[model samples]
Structure formats: C-alpha cells, structure tokens
Target: MSSRERVLAAVAGVAGIAAAATLATPGAAASGRYQHWDDTAYRGQIEVVRSADGPSDPTVLNGTVFVDRDRDSRHDRNERGLAGVEVSNGREVATTDSRGRYRLPVYDNMTVFVTQPAGYQVPVDEFNVAQFHYNHLPAGSPDLRYGGIAPTGPIPDAVNFPLVESRLTDDRRLSCIIAGDLQTYDLDEVEYARKGAIADLARRNDYQGCGSLFVGDVVGDDLSLYDEVKGLTAQTNGPARFLPGNHDLDFDATTAEHSFDTFRAQLAPAYFSYDVGNAHIIALNTVRYPCTPELDNADGLRPECDDPVNRPRYNGAIDATQLEWLRRDLAKVDRDKLIVIAGHIGLLNWADEGSAIHQVDQVREVYSLLHGRKAVALAGHSHSIENLRTGDSMQGWRDLFGVQSLPFPHLTVGAIAGDWYSGQVTEAGYPTALQRDGGRPGVLTLDLHDSSFQERFTVTGESDRVQTQLGLNSPTYREWYVARSAWNRNPVGAAPELGDPLVVDQADLAGGTWLTTNVFMGATGSTVTVRLDDGRPRAAVRTQAMQGEDQLVGPEWSDPVAVAEQLVHGGSVADRTMHLWRFALPADLSPGTHRAHVTATDIHGRRFTDSLTFRVVASR
Candidate 1:
C-alpha cells in the first residue's frame, strides 16, 4: 500500500497525530459541506401530571420506513415505505409491515429505534450523525444531578423514520469506527474533545453514511453533559451511535432495572442489535449496576454476597433477559454475516487483565454461541487498546474466563477520551491524553471486506498511517522511571534523575539502550522491524508474548513518549502492555544523527511504516 508522505512544512502547529501525517490541519477552518441533519430531533420529555389518569396502555409507536426519493427526511405524497426493516422499543421488537408500517409497545422513557437495514441509509444531521430513533419519555427524568432526561409531552401519533438510498451500505465494504470511551466528565472536557478527536473526525469523509460506534463511557458520570458530548460528535462525517458505560449509570436507581434509566433516556437501548450491510452489530449492556455482593463477589471476602437488595456497585455480567435476547437476536441473523458485539467492561482485558469483576462471567457461553461464525468483539472501560487475535492467550483469561484462546478478534478498542482525557492541555484546547498503554488517544476503524476485515487505529489528529510510537529505553531513562515511580507512590522532595532519553553516549551505549516501537494495534502475530540509516532491517522482539504469561512491565516494556508525558501529568501509568516491540541499539555506531525506518505488519499482514530520526551524541 502507498502512503502519503507529509513533510514538516505541512505539519507545523499541528499537534498529536495530525502532525505526523499529510491529512487535514488539526484545527483548520471547515467548508461546512458534511452531511447535515436535525439536532432538535432529540425531542425532550414533558412532565405527565397524574389526575387519576396517566398512560395506562402501551403507547402506540407506529411508523413507516420510507425511502426518501429526494433525500428529504419526510414522507412525500408519492413516497412508499421500505418493508422488513426491524424496529424496537427497548424490549419488545417488531418488524415493518409489507407496506413499510409497524407499531411497537412503547412505555414512558422508552426509546423507539430502527435497526438500519442493509442497502439503505438513514437521515444524518449536519455532523453526519444518524437519526434513526425517537425518545418517548412523556415525563422526563425524575430530577437528578445531571438533569437526566427532559420531558416529552406525550407519545407521538406516528413516529416515522426516513432513509435515503445509498450504495455505501450495499457494497461489500463496511467502514466502521469503534470509538470507545468519549468519557467527557465536564463542559471543559467537551471543549478538549472538540479540539482533539472530534476535530480529526470532522476532517474525514470516509465514513459518511455508515457511522462510528462509541462503544462505552460516552460521559464520565455526569449524564447532564450528554448534550455537550453529542455536540462534539456532530462534527464527524458519519452517523453516530453509542453503548452505555459504567460512568453513564443512574446511581440513584435502587434496582438494576432502573439503573440505566438515564442512559436509556439519553442515548441508546440498554442492549440492542443493528445492521449495516453484511455485519450484524450487537450492542450489549453487560454492566449490572448497584453491583452489590449478590453480583460481584470476586473480592476474596464477602459474607452477604447472596443478599439480593442492590447497593452502590457495578458488575461484569449479562442478565438473563439480555442473554436470552442475544440468543434470540442471533438466531435470526444469517450465519455468514459478521457478528460485531460491543460492550463497556469488555469480555476480557489486560489492565485488570483477568479479574472476574472486569471480564464477563458468561464469556465461555458467548464463545459457544459464536461458534462457526466470523465475529469480533469491541469494548472499553479498561482505558487501554488491545487487539487479542484468535488463539492469543494470557494467564488471566485462562484463569478467569476459563478459556485458553481467543475465539476471534476481541479488540479492547482504546478510548476517544484517552486515559479519562487526562494529561496537559494542548494549543488546540484538548489534552494530550496519552492512554495508559502509552498510545495516544484515538479511534479504531474496521474496514470490512465480506466476513473478513482489516482493523486500523487512527490517533486523534493523526492519519491512518501513523500507527506506532518510537522511543528510546536507555538505562538512564529506566533508572529515572524507577525513581519517579517511587516518588509518585510516596512523594519525596527530590526531583527525578534523567538525561535526554533519546540521545545516547558511549557510556550510555555500553550500559545498553534499546529503540522501542509501541505498535498501537499490534497483536500476537504482529511483527515490527527497524532498519537504521537504510541498513538491514532487524526484527524487533515483542515485549509480551500473550501466551499465558504474566504481563511484562516496567521501563523495559514501557513506551518512553507516554511515560514522559503521563509522569508529568496526573493519570494512570503506562507501565505495561500487550503490544510493544523493542530492538537493541548498536553501541559502535558513528556519533551523528541517524534515521530508523520501522515497519509494523499486523496479523492480517497489512503493513504500516513509520520513521524517526535520533542522535547519538556524547552528552545530553
């Protein structure tokens, strides 16, 4: 594959990933020519007064799936309905009739949504956000901290959805953006998002009709700020969809049933299914809230674990209803179609890696259900990016999930608000929130070709070609890291000791230094190699084998760039990972500047090339 080489001339003032590629400038003026839609479509709820009469019957949510011949979001006199499109209202599902009309039982605070059928497109707002659902909360949120949901007077007589004809969803290729954890906790963080990932997404046109799926943690506990985050998503050139995260829970709800009430009122179903071309997207609600002892008892000591009454807690498990719904939902989907399952806590991860509280308890069951299907799982909440290929294994997964190998590609697809959007602020108004894994904040795109696909991670403000971070892990840097880590844990007065980490001297070389490549989406079979000064390319060894071994951590396994930035700022340490490659630097090199061209090949055999120029000086 050919790459567009972006010279430094086109890269000035561009921060983060944008500075590394030949894409649009990070914060450039826009032409305002992206897909536009109705922001006001999200009708707020209305307070329903009880005078011995509230809504007693299931509100009739009737609608027609019409083909907008002229791309308008309204049914014209001559326009006809598109039959067989699936629609749902939280629980009970229904299909459009032959005449493109259908009705579902909707209750107060229930969202009536359509599972976008193949070969057709939904109406997208100005920011290319797909408008395919309606909020039906006659009485809005029962007043809480984050405002919850506003009141929608009464159920509409007819709730219709408009879709236009498009070849994008009909084609073999499905362009999907797996954006995990846009966890904006406040209004200021919302601004940071606008300047960062949102800016980068706004500049692209690849995923216009088919959208980006923000897996979880759309916000950081402040549900009222949802509109603020949605404002940021309005900049993308694709339809936007989301799954709920633990931070999105309605903490005031005493029972599990009402825990995600705010989330359901605001975003999407607690758990639902959708489709785009050949892929069947299953958005599951794996988080069981008020996760008291009755649910999550993995903590060694729990006397009242069986007590059913809810308390403030969260667990990683799917309830009977959701699981049963999943089975029934999958029963209808064609076996040949790719199953794209997404959630928040992740089926498994490397951060908590193998804790029972983090991974779902029914992973083996999920694996069993997906037997013989071409599938992949996407998740977040661990605040790290992980691409666990088929057959990949770790001790945690084996011990907790009771599985020795991954059945398919289970990508803990990083986070949009990387590391809780932590780190120092940038000129663009966003933080340089490098993730806990040392990866810069980013989104993952799955380029689907039939049942198979190529996964690509785009660092915010960076291009697709920018996939790896190169660093120098010298003895001096390692020592400084150790001192700094201790100082952080116990706070000493003395500052950390370290020199210019990138530059090496004779004594430093003798002490052993390595050139490290932190391949962002690298998996078990992925290989990274570096060639110095256009010389022979020596294969760089991956730090962790992911073969049932304990995670390899510390400075040797760390990404120097992430460590440097995160250590200065307040956030989780990027001390260990499943995707880092290192190469020992030659001590006998000539003392001038030299360029190292590194090539990383993913499991699918696609190559991403990156280069860095480093100096070998006498002193720093």
Candidate 2:
C-alpha cells in the first residue's frame, strides 16, 4: 500500500479504539476518569436557533453569549446573556451588546469564534479540547484526502455561545502553559506523550485558567491521529488549545487556503487571540504549505518550496490576510497589557537561526506592530529550548529577513516529543528523547503577574529545580564525539562508547579541558559560574554571544554529557546550542578526584545550581 493509505488505515484503527478507551490519570483509580467540560446529557453545542421560515437576513450573522447555569447546551429563557463578550469572524471583531447579543458579517470559509471572556469558562469536548469556535464553509472543501470540513449551509438566525462562570480566569496572576510539538506519529508515540508531558500537565493545577496552549505539530503526517492526540489532553487539568504546525497540515490539499482545513475543523482557528489577566495571548499560524516563489520571502534560500509538482513543501510564512488580522487584533488589545505572541515556528530562533525556511518571513512586520509595547514571542518546531533576550541577532536573520536584533524576548520551547521520540524507552514509560540541543522533553510556562512575566521550563517527569545539565568536555571526549558522530551517519556495528567521560589525563587537560553546562533556559544577561571544591567562584563564558554572529557549532560547542547518552542509546546529538556555557579547567590539577559546582542565573535574576565530580589522573 502507499504511505498515505497506510497512514489513513493506522488513523482509522486508532480512532475506533480511542472512542472506547479512557485515558486514566497517572496513579488514579482505573474507574476514576476525569469529566469533560461539555458532557451534558443535552449534548453540548452552540445553540444555533433558527426561524421556521429561515433567516430574514443571510448576509449578517448574529450570536448571543449566555450563561449556561444548568449546564445545558441551550440558552434557556431564565439563563441571562453575558454582556460585552468578544466575538469574531476571523477578521472582523465584535462584542456582545447589553443583552449579550453580537452580530458579524457572514462570509464563506470563515471561522466564527468567541474570545472567551475572563471570569468565564468555555465548554470542552470529551477530549478536554476547548470548544469556542464554529466553522462556516458554504460549499465545503474541494476533493481531498483526510476529508476536510463538511458543508455548513446558510447562516443560522442565531448562533448563541454557552459559557459558565469561573473564578480560575479571574485572577490577575496567571500561569500559562506553552507546550510545543506533541508530534506523535502513531499510537505508540501517543502513549509516550500520555506518559511524558500530558502526565506532567495532569499533575499540575496551576494553569486551569489561562490553560495549556499547545504550540503546533500536534501529530506527525497522520492528520487522522488528531482524535487520538486529543485523547491525551483529556488527562490534563486545563482547557487544551492548539496551534497548527507544518506537520499538522493536510498535505493532500492543493491550495494554501484549504491546507489546514482538517486541522481547523478538529483543533482551532488557524490563528486567533484571547485575553486573560493582564495579558493578551495571540496564537499565530506561521506555517504556509506549498509556498510558491511569489509568497516566499527567504531571498531564494527556500528554492525547494518553488517546486509544486515533484516537491511541494511548506515554508515559514504569514500570509497578508493573517498579518492584517494580527494588526487589527493588536489594535483592540490594551497597550499596558503584555502581548504574548505564540506560533508553531518562531519569529526567529537559535536552532534554525540561519535557516530561512524554518523561521517566519514576516517577523519584521510583527515586530513593528508591537514596536514599543511589552511583548514576547514563543514557538516550537525547532525542538530546542532557547531563551533569547532582546538584542540577540544572527547573520542569517540580518541577511535573510533584514532583522538585526530581537525587539523583545523570543523563546523556542523544547518539544514534548523530543527529537520525534527517537531514543530508548525509560522506566517512566517514555523515551529518553533528548532534543537537538541536548534538552529533554518538557513544557514551558509563563508565570505572569499583571503585565510582567517569567519563563520556566519543566523537564518531563522532573522537577523545575532540574534546569542545568553538567558535562565534562576534554580532548578524549571530543575524539569520541567525532568518531561516534561519523558512525551514527552510517551504522555497521556496535557504536563506540564514550569511556570514562569524567576522567581525563595530563595530555587531555593540556590539549584543552573544560566543564560544560547546558542551562536549558539560559539567555543574555544570565551568568554561569563554576566553583571547585574549597575554591572561589570562577565565571563561565557562554558559547554563543547572540550578537549578530554566526552559529558556533561542532564538538567544541557540544554538551558531552548529553551526547554520551544520545550516541549510546539513540537520539539527536547535542552538537550546538545557544545556551551552553563552558569553564576552562586548570591544567595543573593534582592526580585525584575533584568536584565542581555550577550556578546559572537567568535574565529574571532566578538562580539554579548543579554540581558534578571528575577525576584528574597522571595518565589514562
């Protein structure tokens, strides 16, 4: 069978089993299943009440945001309508009147959705996926695989939205979870996600209000696994929302307009924004499938996308319509509130800092929109953790996108399905899936208080305290890295092991020895200091200065500790990272065991310390 057919069959098989299966919370009783937000007996749906003779005006669509006190999907006579609730038709924004009624101009191929006002909660499906939008496609999608959105005829006389009051979103302080790349290929990878990142989110109650916003790549090429993917979110504590990534596209589609039709029908609008606390979180769709030469702004770097026949590919871009929508969306947002811009691909990142097809093309326009306001960009796709601060620039960004420096902080939150779940399985029921930058599978959270926020990354099944990874980089290890890396390219036999990584000889130190620290979220203004046993603290220099320079890659900039695990077990090499810091070891150390303590201070002034021990022998 063809690969597409195989994917469809796999999706069909999983969907049947997923419908009957329940994702039990970790350590909870088998019978104790978490309840969905909109599992009412009345069948939760937007109350699209229509007149017997159809609507008087088809051009204008009307809606009401009502309080669903009885938990019914319908808006009862007694149930009052919510006032000043925001609603949109992808481009135009409208708010509910005093009577909770909102009217917007109707259009083809538009998604009508509510902003989900603060102090109120939107109902969720059985998979814990938030239900706040309705798709209106008059004629439906053209012939395509994965069956895009079905036809929804004329506009209803009234499309009322149901909501319930919640104190969770009312708080001024919010903890917003930004999970990246849950790129599960099949059912097995789905299980790994359930055990890894989903379990971590299930165990936490801190983000119930702002909820968990998964930043793209919800699955691999199999769009049919969306249901199985949604089942994982059923185990989490908050209303799960999602953004579209390159992997999440319906590749069978020919046009860019219908590229994400299946995703929008199943997950969310391609791009949208909502307000919570003092922050206006804008979720963007930065990926454009089948990018033609007319659309690509990569300065001919992405000639691969120019081919529509043999190799129709996706490019990191924001269409003119989406950019205009973003401008309109920002105008409505308060200037004092923090603007949290999120997408699948970053505006610019450390891993793909030099790749034009990997970063957004319209990033400069986006920066101009929030010219002086307090804003931060968050993204996935790179599968690396990067906490880049203002003024961080790269030669590629300067040459390709005409961007010299970052206007504000831009972060690439590490993926939950690290390196596509490519490593050995651990006792925790998940893969040791180390990322490209030597970071583990984890989720990022923005701890926001009013207009200010701090970013934190929690490694899967690990505590927040476990931030930095320590390793020894010596001449011996560098040689092992070169050998193993070459062998990894064309495997023939058992791989060469990095022996006694912490041990080094006189010649090894003389050739250049250093202690490497991979601070997962370390950025500019952050400092890494190392202290030997009973010695003064010595400063460690960051490998990448991020000051309009080219990427410093290879073994010299690698995290030896992480590379050891990846090469022996199986995963991406930690060859290059923007967060690595190295402290040169003294060559004249005595022939004995020595201890080194590492302390990394972040841009937020928060400090995390780790320690490692190594031996100094006369000869190996």
Candidate 3:
C-alpha cells in the first residue's frame, strides 16, 4: 500500500481504540465565549468589625464561620453559623466550635484565613480571586519597594467569614486545573498568555468549582503587574487562586517575613489549604528568599546566598513555622482524601533532579507527614513537564534530600509562559513557546473520582488529542546539532536548520538511527510501541529510566523535533527528558520510503497514537 493509504489506515485504527472515547468531556468541549461569574452573581465577603480603640484583648482574636443565607457579606441574626470549619493564623489550624465561633492566639504579623470547606465556597472579588483571608499585620511590613502590605491596624472585633452553599463543590467527581508559571514579564507577554492558555480556559466550564491554582511566578519581577495578571483570571470560568514564587517577592524587604507581603496583599495567603470533593489541596510557600548562611544547610551549598547584601538568592525550602502548620493542617484532614501538595518549586523534579537548591529541602520531612496517606505533589519552577510516579528516583533525590524514591507521584506541571514565552509567534496570537522538555505550553487537569484521579494535560489552543511529538534520531541529525548548537551560542549569521530530518542514509542506519517519541506526560508503567507498515509492533524503550539513575543527557538523548525549533529560533534545548522513548530501526532493512505508526499508552491506561513517514535512501 502507498504511504497515503497507510496514513489513512492509521487514522481509521485510532477510531476503534476504546481509549479515544475517554479523551474529552462535555464540560471541556469549547462552547462559544464562556459567560464568567461577575461580581453581581456572588457578592460575599468576611465581615470585619473594626473599632476606633481596637480590640481590648490584642492577644486573642475571635471569629465565626457563618452560612450566608442572604448572599451578603454580613453575619445577620437570622443567618446561622457553620460548625466544624477549619481556620488558620498561618501557623496554627483552628476549628469552629458548635456555634461556628472560634478563638485563636493572635500574632504580630499573620494572615487569618478560613479553608473553604467542601459543599461551600468563600467569597470572590471582581477578578474571581477567592477572598478567604484577612491579613492581621498590625504595623504591616517594614518599608519595602513594592509597598509591602499597608498597616492593617489592630485586630478587628470579630472577623466573621461568610460562605455560600454550592452543589458544584460537593460533587464526588471533580476537575482541578493545576497551571504553572504564567510568569508574564510585561503586558505584551500577558497578552500572549491571555490569547493562549487563558483563552483556552475561558472557553471551558468544567473546573468552575475546583478552579485554577496558578502554582507560582504569576508575573516576572514586576509586582506592579499583579493587578493586570489578576484581571486575566477574571476571564476564566472559575475562582482563580495563587501562591508566591521567587519572582513574586518584594525584593526590597530585608527580612524574609515581609518578602511576600505584597503578594499576599494582591493574590492569596502564602500557604493555605482548601477542600473540594475528596481532594484536600494544600498550596505551600516553598520559596525562601535572600537565603542567608544563618539558615540551616545554606552555609556551604549556596554561594550566591552568602552575600544577602547583593546576590539575595532564593532557595526551595519550607520554614519551621510553615512545616509545623503543615503537620497541624494534615492532622485535621481525613486520610481517605487525596492530598495535593503544591508549591512553586518541585519537591523533586527531572530538570533539577540533582540540584540541592531547586528541589524542596524539607521533602523528606514532608513525606513523613503524609506517610500512609494518598498524596500527589505538584510544582512548576523548572518549566518542564515531569510526571514522576511512585518509586521513581534520581541520584540527586537520594543524595541530597535523602529520598530513596517517590512514595507518591510528584508532577512538575509545565509553565503557561513556556520557556519564558520564547520562540516564533504563531497565528494563534501567542508564541509557540516550546518548553524545556519539548512539551507544549499547557495546563494539567486532575479528573477526580472519589479519592482517585486521572491526570490529563490540555495544550494551550489544542485539544487533549495532541499529546505526543514524533521525530527521527539519525546519525546525521547529531552532527548538525553539535554544529548548530555551537553557532546558537555564538551566532555569526542565521544558523542553518536541520536538513531532511525525515530522510536517513545508509550510514545513519548502520551507525545508529531510531524513531523518537516525546510523550508530554508519560510516567512509569506507560508503554510506547512502534509498528512499521504491515509489520509487528515493537516496544520502544524510555530514555531516562528514573530508577535511581543519574540524568542521561547529550545529543544522543535529545529530541530532534524540539532541538530544531530551539536551536534555530529561541527556547531551552530539549536535551534531556524523563518522558522520551525510542525504538531502534534494523540496519538490514531495504532502502525505500517507510511509514511508522507509534502508540503510547500512559500509566492511566489511556492510549494515544501518531504516525510519521520517512525516506531511507541507499546513499546520502
């Protein structure tokens, strides 16, 4: 049969695959422009009773979590208080009593927030930002560049939190979106993001309840852009939540306590938790800015951190106070629920698998806390898509963090601003923005049923159908890579692109040539198989085994498809990835045009198929 016939056959075969039926959901299907919830739709807020003389007892703060029957931000006499709700002062977890009233010891500077319980939701402002927290910084933060938090004078008389009932939040089946690094440096980049992922999210209403948790780096160094970035979230169909990144820090703050004050003022609590369905999502503040030698384990490992005066580097760490809070927070959660531990920096990741500063320093301790619980960690500092499953290990994880292997899956959800939004601009109104792992910019959706979930990644303007990228790794491509990579470093002129990537000569087949498959979310137990036209299917081996092995990198391990775009245009080179798989071609094959059909079955047992045709000439 001709190559065109084979392509048609492969397309037809995909229709019969049972997994294809489960690809997209009705709520995920693109309707016209989604009508997002405006301010008039839900007007709820925490009732703060302030006094001219302030609270008599400054050490103790009292609050009530009440049912907002009138949809108002007040605690009316008729509206009853909700009991058994969780509240926090950033360090301690407090539960509401029988009457929904609770008292907690107050601190000088802390955010008192209520964890939006299942079956109900906290109030959202104009931008759909959940307003659950009340900052209690009496004197506020010290003088900082970004106007850190303005002085929130003495504690209010009663910080009454108002919550509204919602059937969406109570559903057993939930879809939670984990988006990383919107990281817009300027308004132009913001527009790129608006047209890309934000636009895609705006069209879907599936995640209206669980909403979108933007992991970190909301804006590049400009905290001034927080307002602009929050405006983009208004277009999305759900409540938008956030955690702070190194970029989101108020750099002028000399003390670490006030580093993220401005971020908390604009976005969310630095660390907080909420419940939806059977999932308990915990957003942690993992970035420790201006990490000095004074901190434990920072003396010798990081040189940039030595000079807090000039360098002022950030490290992936959880402070003692926050760690204590985590223990208290977990104590209140039911072990049956799925615990999603999210942060800006990964607890452990493939990109920085060996680096001590990039991965969280307290990973081992955090693991011990969730020892027997069902949990999954999600992060996005590295700008790579990593689906590291249970028992997956790297040399760095064992060496630095003392973690032998992952007890639970830790996923580095790829960034919204892919590779800092670099590469060629596409007609879709955004840059191609290919990631460091060769994965396209996308958001991760955890479709949960009870406590279990199936993770799916939807590319920014593409459907879930687009998952894998196909490429041929020939001996000739390697030679071009070395030459062009050097030229990219020190460009003399326009660097030449890879020539005839699909055409392999006799030398290429003899030396080494194979078909490479880059599965964006491939994890352990995931399998890739390649079938030549009319031939039996052969198994493809994963490049990085992720079983206590050091990272394997170089031209031989690179994705030719991603390298071509990065070297010619602009983006991080996809030199190493845990999700790459390859199938070696036989050297004894006759020279002719050939077609290969590739099928990748993920750990969730969902299968995705793609086909590529290449020419095998007798000689170059």
Candidate 4:
C-alpha cells in the first residue's frame, strides 16, 4: 500500500473512539518532543470490572507524572506533581494535568507509559530498569510455559511515575547506546556479560542521556534469567531499557496478545518511544513468537511456524496493529528531528541475508513514513556488525523487504554475548564470542548532533580506539579453511586446520595474499587504504559491494584473524560480511619484516588508522 493508504488506515484505527476527558500535560515547556496537551482522570480508584464485564474500561486507565523530590520512587505527601508530561497508551496519546496527573482510556492489555521529558530523569530500580510504565491486564495471561503477567487486579488509586531532576539530558548533544543481543542462556553467560560489556559501561558516565537500549534476545529461551539480566543492567552507569526478542517470548502462550507478558512485567514496554535532546528514540517489538513448529535445520531456513491453530512459527514482520500504532506514534514526531528506530529483528540484513523471515515485512511501510524525516535504524538478532548507509543494498533486502536500497543509515549493532558466548574463555572470564561475520562482541553508540550523527563501535573491555580487526586472507588460509570445513563436518584432529595464522611464506605470497580489515562501523562512503613499508598507498576493495549481489559466505570469505581465534577457541567463524576489505600484497617484495599502515575512514569522515606487521620468510 502507498504511504497515503497507510495513513488512511491509521485514521480508520481511531474508530470506535468514545467521548473522553481532556488530555494535556500542564505547565510545561512547549517545543520539540511534546507540544499540545490532553487531560486525563478516572474515579477515586478503578476496579477491574470483571473479565465478564468485557475489556477494562478505556477511560479509567490513569496515572501520575510527578516529581519524586526525595527520589524515593513513590509520590509522597509533600511531593508536588509536575505538569505537562506526555503519557501514551501506544494508540491514544495524552499529557499530564496541572497537578501532574493523567488518565487515558485503556483495555485489558494496553501499556500506559510516560514519554520522559528532556530535563528530568525517570526513576530506575536497582536494576536500572526505568519505571515509566504501568501495564493493565486485569485478569492476567492465560496459562503458558513462561509465566506471563499475574493479574494486576483493580487499578490503584494512583499509578504514579517519579522523575528526578537531572542536567545530563537537557540539550541537543546526546549519546544513545544501541547494543545488540546479550542472549545469555544461563547465569555463567551472565557472568560473561558482567566481565565484558557491562563492566565497560559501568566505567563510563556518558550514556546517561539515552541510556542503553539492548535491542533484543535479552536472554536465551529461558525466561528465568530475567533477573540476572537485570542484575547485569544494575552495573551500568545509566538507566537501561530492553525490547523483546524471539528468544524472549513465552512460546507456550496460546495467543499473540500474551506472548510477551512476562517480559512486559519485568522489562520496559514491549514497544515504546522517548526523546532526549533532538533525538526521538523508538524501541519496537520486531520479533513474532512461535515462528515455526520446531527449530531450524541445516537444510533450510526455519519454517514459518505461525500456524495460529496449530504449531506457531515466529516471523520478522510487524502486525497491522503495530503498524497502525507506529503510524499514530510517528504522527506526533516532528519532521526535522532525528528518529532512531530500533527493533530486535533488523529491517534488512546481510547475515541470514538468505532468510526472508529474518527481516521485517513492513520495512517499506516504515521507510515510507520516515522518508521525509531524519532517520536511522538499529537492530540485533543477526549477531553481525553492519553499518548500511543510504543507498546500501543487498540481494536479500531487495528480494525480501522489497527495499531497493537503504533510504537512511541502517545499522546492525554487534552482540554483547558474541556468537552466543562461544569461543575461548578469556582471563577476563568472557568468551571471545566472535560473530558469524567475525566482528568482535561489542556495543554501538550514536553521538547525536541535532538530527544527524556519527556511528562508532567499541569492543568490550577495550577503548573506542580499538575499531578494526586486521587479518590475512591468503591461499594458505584458504587451504586451511577447506580442511577446517571438512573437519567441522567430520572431526580429524584435536586442533582444527588453522595453521600458524600470523606468518606467511613465499609460496603463500606467490599464490596471492591479501590483508583484510573488518571495520566494525564501516559503511558506504568509507575508505580502506594501505601503504606497505612506507610504499605508495593502495585502496582495498570491499567484499560485498551491497549493490544487489548474493551474499558471499563460508571459509573462503572468512576473516583469517577472527577465524584463528574462533576455530581454535570455539565460537562463530567470521567468514562473511559487507564491511571486510582486502588489499593484495606484492609477491616480489624482499623477504623481511613489513608493516601495513592501514587507514579506514567511515561515512562520517572519521579516520581510524592502525598498522599490522608480518614477517615474510624466504621459505617456511
């Protein structure tokens, strides 16, 4: 459908609307994020008019947006209500009153939340999970394997949200963290999280503005690990938020409505938006649960299990309801501001580039709505680090999402629990968890300047300076790859086929050897140039041109350096990607120690230079 048709559909969604109370956030500054106000109120206290009485009354979903003067997290007798704070029910948007109060018509499973204003910080529990929402599910969820929302009986006299005054997020300059999956299946993996990325975040105070938005797959299939995930978040220096992933769902739930109840009860809303400075961040529930009757096999992509009547399959598309809700939400955002759209499943991807079910079906619709606006999308679920700039394209995106090319920057943030915490356990106690494309496990940050920004990736337990991974892709390495693939299919030795990785012989150079670098945030307009031993500079070629070619995969396309670590230590092989670049070496150069001074420049013109030295032997 055209963008116009989608808007008309959204307008049609506002149907069945009944007369309601005034909606407004009183006595607040008007500009940017929230301007117009609507009033809300309910009875002294709301009773869960029995499930038999039908869906909870829409108008009685009420709450307060107050100043927690003591930071006690509850409305105290002397605490004054802050006016003009916007509150929303995903569909119907409202604002607080002069008394810092709000009310909106709500149903059985609606999320009533406050879009935290700019100057004040929302209250975070010990785990740094922001307390900005109140879920209303009067009768609770039906019986399911993962326990969902317990009946949140009658509405309390007040569902109060506390905001503390802060100077950190008051302006246009902001640092928003877009972290990929931390798919920890057990407590041990949680420890890896603690020692790796969480520890790194604890050392910095910069991201307190937009905080950390863990894209998804927060945990493996086990919902029991939610608290441990919370424990990891508590270690961060700023507030943390989460969106649900395919693994984070209750697969046993009979219907879609209760799919993420437990997650909603423990984390932030399944989908929500907030603003800081000029950046408007929207977190979405991109994963659809029970995607297949069973699991993915080696033969093909996971089957669509979403047989609503039988075995349900998870999918990578947004439903009509969410599309309508997104339409309504974006309607409130300004045209010129930065819109950071985040989801678990990427809108389009290079990893799983062959699977149509791994990307969103509504990618085109979303692009249509966000066309005129300054936008960037961040996602997880595909464990690779991808920075797709405007005009970046791949066969899968065009074939699956129907998107010919990226309209704006679309990034696939690297995972925190890299490759499912695979590889060797470090002395630091974390696994190398090298991703499928060989990118290191790390997090991404968007340094916002008004509506535009520069993207940077920081390897965990390392500095921002550690931006690229250098490796050798030679005939020798390719031979080892063939052997390794065979051995992986059928074991041959204790150690894999990877030989001494850093060394290259005359034969290896004679056959052809290329120095490869995987720049984590490299994208279109980026340049990778090399100068050997102070020789003339030469530009390297990016493997995946992203101009509508099929994805290049397997050992032939793998990064030798990351492969060396992953193959021997046990993690994913970084064998394929769009950002890995290679520079051919001169075969006749004299046998001696040589250094390749490599310079990589990102789309933003940020240059990161690093040198790799290799000893060329006459014969080894």
lDDT of each: 0.74, 0.82, 0.85, 0.75
Pairwise lDDT winner, candidates 2 and 3:
3
TM-score, per-candidate, Cα-based: 0.85, 0.91, 0.94, 0.86
Error of 4 at 205 (Å): 1.0
Deviation (Å) of 209 in candidate 1: 2.0
RMSD, one per candidate, in order: 5.9, 8.0, 4.0, 12.7
Best by TM-score: 3
Task: Tell me the number of clashing residue pairs for each predicted model.
Answer: 14, 0, 0, 31
Give per-residue CA lDDT, model 1, range 332-398, as digits (tens). Answer: 7889999999999888777776567677877888888889999999899888889988888888888
Q: Write the per-residue lDDT of candidate 2 for residues 1-620, one digit (tens) a residue.
A: 43223222221221011111122222122113233423321225577777777678989998899999997788989999999888888888887889899999988889888887777788777677888888889888877687889888778788889988876666666788899999999999999999888998877767767788999999998999999987888777778889999999989888899999999988999988877788888999999988887778346788878886578899888999888878877887779989999999999998988888899888889999999999999999999999989888899889888998989999899999988897667768988778999887899988877798888888888767667777788999899889888898888898776667767899988999999888889889989999988899999999999989999888999987667777766778888999999999998877898988778887776677677777899997
Show pairs that collide, candidate 3: none
Model 2: clashing residue pairs? Answer: none
Model 3 lDDT tens row, 1-620: 54223322222222123123234543455222234555333555678988888778889899899999898799999988899999999888999998999888899999999998999988888788888998889788888888888998888888999999977777777788899999999999999999999999887877877888999999999999999997899888787899989899999888688899999998899999999988899999999987887783554665556778787888899999999999999999998999999999988888998887898888989999999999999999999999989999899888887889999999899999989988777777888777888888989988877898778887788777777877788889899889998887788987655666777988999999989888899999999999987899999999999889999999889887777777766789989988999999889767998888888998877788777878899987
Q: By TM-score, is 3 or 4 better?
A: 3
Q: In angstroms, how far off is 287's CA in candidate 2? A: 0.8
